[model samples]
Target: MATIRALVPTQLERRMKTPAFGRRALLAGFGIGALGALTGCRAEGFAPSAVPNGNIGSNLNIYTWGDYSDPANLEEFGRQGVQVQTDSFASNEELIAKLGATRGTSGYDIVVPTSTYLTLMSKNGLLEKLDLGKIPNLANLDPEFQDSIADPQNAYAVCKNWGTTGFLYDSTVINRPMNSWADFLEAAQNEASNNVSLLEDPAEIAVIYLAAKGYDPLSTDPKIVAECADYLTNQLAPHVRAFSSTPQNFIIQGSMTLVHAFNGDARRGYLEAENPERWKWVFPTPTANRWMDTWAIPVGVQHPDAAYAFINFMLQPDQALKDVDYIGYSTGLTGQRELAEAAGLKMLDVLFPPAEILDRLVSLEITEASGAWVDMYGAMQAKAGA
Candidate 1:
């Protein structure tokens, strides 16, 4: 299938020379100006047109990705007179499902939903309207991130950290070069057959198949999604050894030769691995799912003051740098990105990438096909467990 190419941005035009080169950790990345100050890459200048007065208070109960938020940040938040507590989920879908089931009665003052999930959560009246004045750092965000079409006016969610999904392979285990989706699927069924692992999220894997076959990942077509499910269960099931959102150990410790992992997780695997050179990340050409994990408040927030305070505190450039460094993810906060660079954080660009890539980057969201996607994942899980 011809790769889905979008109209090029000049910034990406310069980057197109080595667009998908994700091999080496030290490859100098094209400047995105997004995190560091390039046009269309930076998130400055798009903060709220007006600020709202938000009540200040102490104590907050937050929910987020299992390892996404740094514990130290929480400790510091506690020290600020706001007693802070946190719970976490493995995936955004898990977080949304659990929170929706509870209807904010769970008493979580804050929750982190990816960009795609934010719209639904907000529309469902699950999230509270954010007071931009309370979050002064919104001005620090790249204008691109600040003006989210999904949560227009920044009423419900403020995207803070973003990353992409792709696979990490142990070069020592699989001798051949694996770049495209075809190469990955081939390895799964043959050389690395039944020895590979994939992320448990159905959408993550489905995006790969959709992109490879030139179908939009965001399509709500039942037939198309059902086909994706069939492909996941029949064609990819036998080759999967395990399915996990947290596949860090599988890739880092050599339990699985090829682990479908987030860009940050795979980078973490490489950084923590005993044999770092043996592990490598691959971002499929034409497209990849670029998602933003955002901070939002539950409808009936227990501590509005603390929630806003905590969000602003995290937006502080130093804290944002620490957050990204610990998680191995990238943020669109230009200030934070520069700090990471000055601090010599390696591969920050690869995890983040130039803004041009965002043009081809797909945003996977809840759609009419959600049910089919879930059923498809259930089938894949059943087979893997069997």
Candidate 2:
């Protein structure tokens, strides 16, 4: 996921900085200015428009990850007289902090958070209970995602899109068959030394060490967590060029040869690269994180009807296809793979992995020990002078 440097203003700046990079940007050949115009909002000095009186208001405010939504969809929705405004968060922590500090008066009607954060957000009364009745398209969701472990009853969130956490390497540079996290580590230390980039996420960084060592990546045991931290600080950190969530740019620039990345971004980087055949994506064995991002309404949502309408509209097969095609992630909707193939999306294997690869993927759960992993990551980064 792309990290937003600041809450709103920085998001606009980042979009402007990389206007012609993402698939949507390339396909439409428009910059952030054009996108803002199409969505009925100005990229500079953007603020939520007045919500006209109605069940579905005239404006919808969305808070989500950067480059996750397609401008075309929002523009199409705008044709119905509902102006759309989107702001981005760098991480779940940033999302939680902004919402918590505002005490639910952030003016955001909808938020897309990773599924693991659903229970925490609901417990804190940060989220509003979703009325599935408003979303008849819920039936269109894949049965597997319908029973989310974090929100099993679908009381608070609906799966938006899902992808795996893995690494990718430039085959032309490495000259080795890289498959597992172990190989990733070795390559990082040798062939890719001083040029490797890992995701800027703590929990994701933990997965690299823990999964490679044959331990549960989500393991909260203090000893295991400490061990992973030690390995990162002592072994992996020296070789890492940068810690970043948006490594696609580095991949495209040919600045980083191997990167720890979410499959979606890796696929995007691969396809966008000048020599795409040099990139090799891996579904690391024997385990990796299979994360799902979800759509939920915040507690003080001002445009509830518009929130429901937008969610339901996105759940439709056609919109979902556009979403997956643009973002390069699975929407957890049935037959999405077939739809994507029919639409001529490249890198189907990376976007929708095989069943065997899926079986090795694991879901991350928020637990009391979650904070320990974050602390370990910080300590590792500090000790390594990263």
Candidate 3:
């Protein structure tokens, strides 16, 4: 695995300025840099010996979203004999780019990509087929996450965590009954104007207008894409305060009154706020995107044994519960709600929505036309001066 021992403070500072690295730095409480700088450090009296080619080694490397993994869990895994290293990426595009550039020889044993990208990555020969027999805890997953559209046979990936895209607001600032995306729009234009924020993700931002208008948020038709792009650039962009994916800091600082955010981040913001009651998290009416991130081994995995071991280890209920508490997302394990509440998870309703809300959530798929959505998003951002 690549080490960061040669990275000076100046080099680390420059990397932290990029959107991908910056988001990870912020979410991990700036520990990502510290971890990178100290990559050579190991647990007391522990030194993993290198293994020969095509053989299992006492090392596992991961590429995932920032702050998605808990340090305590990793330490426990280390105690079991394998040493682990992790790196972060901000978006799926960045993940694909780096892995593609290396032709899957990036030396990363485990990667966490959204379910929508699983099929695409597998088709490109960037991922390896999973050995289901090695992951006995696979049965612990909720049936709903099994036989997924992205990997029907659990061939390449297994769901790690799932969350929905939604908006959050400070009820104290916009004190009206808010329930739907329509209400979100009204508040953004009126009370929350010049102080509203939307996610930096183009597909996520497009969903807001597409779903509110009762259209398929994933539609890639040229006309629909153009229409959504026009409306976002002309009607909505002016009211947006900023484009960001990490809104927890702004929410706690009271810098942005309303923000389009993911469920886990929104919950973290609400819970961390001084007056938690003032923050309101909404599922939004009509529809929203429900995304799932999964664990998959890259084609050039050097430590298949360690990769399988870590996956099985994380799926256990005890370890899964710790992940839920640290990351604030559901693990899709059976009876997760009861387990979470038994462990004293605050605001159970926010993390686990009611059945009606759950029914309205939709998973996104990647198509050839997905590139057009990216182009349309670029146009919207350029026009909005964002």
Candidate 4:
């Protein structure tokens, strides 16, 4: 068992600073200048001609993950003579709630949310449709990214990066071939007893429950989701060690025998733990939901051109490569294949798992833009928490 210490950003600030490195990355990160005056890294200058033509808002307020954007990235925008500031959110739900409360008057220019949430926001008219013509770098995105379920038409948002969720288990504790989500739940039930932990968030739990019941978590039916809620509370709740919203540190200290974890976190854990084989990953059998983070221009963004410039610039092969390395996820950039190989990242199966295995994975998706489903999912989560 490992003690899991998760690095969750505070509810107030909801972000942490990544160490600024790489010459080009440093320059690109200059986009973070307006957020703070501190200079961490510098990148090539951000410049674009397609500044929004009509009724664009002046204040470039952005809401995103703390580490996703930095002082340097802000500084790059600042250099473009755009006024920008950022607010961080810990979860997609929090950002959704904020956007609703502000009612499209939040004065934010950009909002980066997970792929699933992009659908919800787009349906609600919270996101501004991207003018791809202005973002020529859209061409640089990998084919997998260009083809997304949430934004099928490439209209609402753009994929930034993607990763997966599963369990990081101690291979020696109860050695057997661990292959799927069901195996993890069974082991958590048998090995950890009441100490077994799962992700505390409703969205993930709902998805896991659906997987357990052989149903898609993104299913829109109210009755089916209710069935999922009942299934989780009845079957797995007793074995749960803890419903951890953040479980990183627990795994680190050997307090967690099995953890529902992200692939990147699992990789970091394997690297940090002295016993390399002690930590291993499990990709669900049929499929587990793939996670993606994306970028969107808010409705009132004044510096849409700079924002597009930044996105296109980020689409550059080198920029995407740096992001993949720094963020610990596979990006939708064409160059990562060679870059990851050259960087020896291919050796990390958790990062670059076997081709056949990845083919079996599925990204969670919304069946329809329905408030009823969201409410149903939310209710199921509340029950799981109880």
Model 1 is weakest, by summed lDDT over 10 consecutive residues, at 33-42
Instruction: Report the alpha-carbon TM-score of model 1 versus the true structure.
Output: 0.81
**What root-mean-square deviation over C-alphas does model 1 reach?**
12.3
Error of 2 at 61 (Å): 1.3
Residue 368 of model 4, lDDT score: 41
- When sorted by TM-score, best at the front, the candidate numbers are 3, 2, 1, 4
* TM-score against truth, every candidate: 0.81, 0.85, 0.86, 0.77
3 or 4: which has the higher lDDT? 3
RMSD of each: 12.3, 7.4, 6.6, 8.6
lDDT by residue (1-386, candidate 4, tens digit) is 11111112232122122221110121223123333322222234334434454222234567776556435445654554455676666556556656766666766667878887676677776778888887777877878778587788679888777777788777778688887667766786687555565764445666666676677666867688667666666666666656554455556677778777677666666666666667767777667767788888866565675567666656777667766676567767766777887877633567765678779677765454233333443343344424
- Which 10-residue window in model 2 sums to the lowest lDDT? 23-32
Please give the lDDT score for candidate 1.
0.69
- Model 4 earns a TM-score of 0.77
Off by over 4 Å in 4: 1-60, 70-84, 220-227, 344-347, 366-386
Give the better candidate number (1 or 4) by TM-score: 1
lDDT of 3 by residue, 54-96 (tens): 1335678888887787787887776655668888776665576
The Cα local distance difference test for each model comes to 0.69, 0.76, 0.75, 0.62
Ranking by lDDT: 2, 3, 1, 4
Question: For residues 216-247, what per-residue lDDT tens digits would candidate 1 score against the true structure?
Answer: 88887777877778877888886788876567
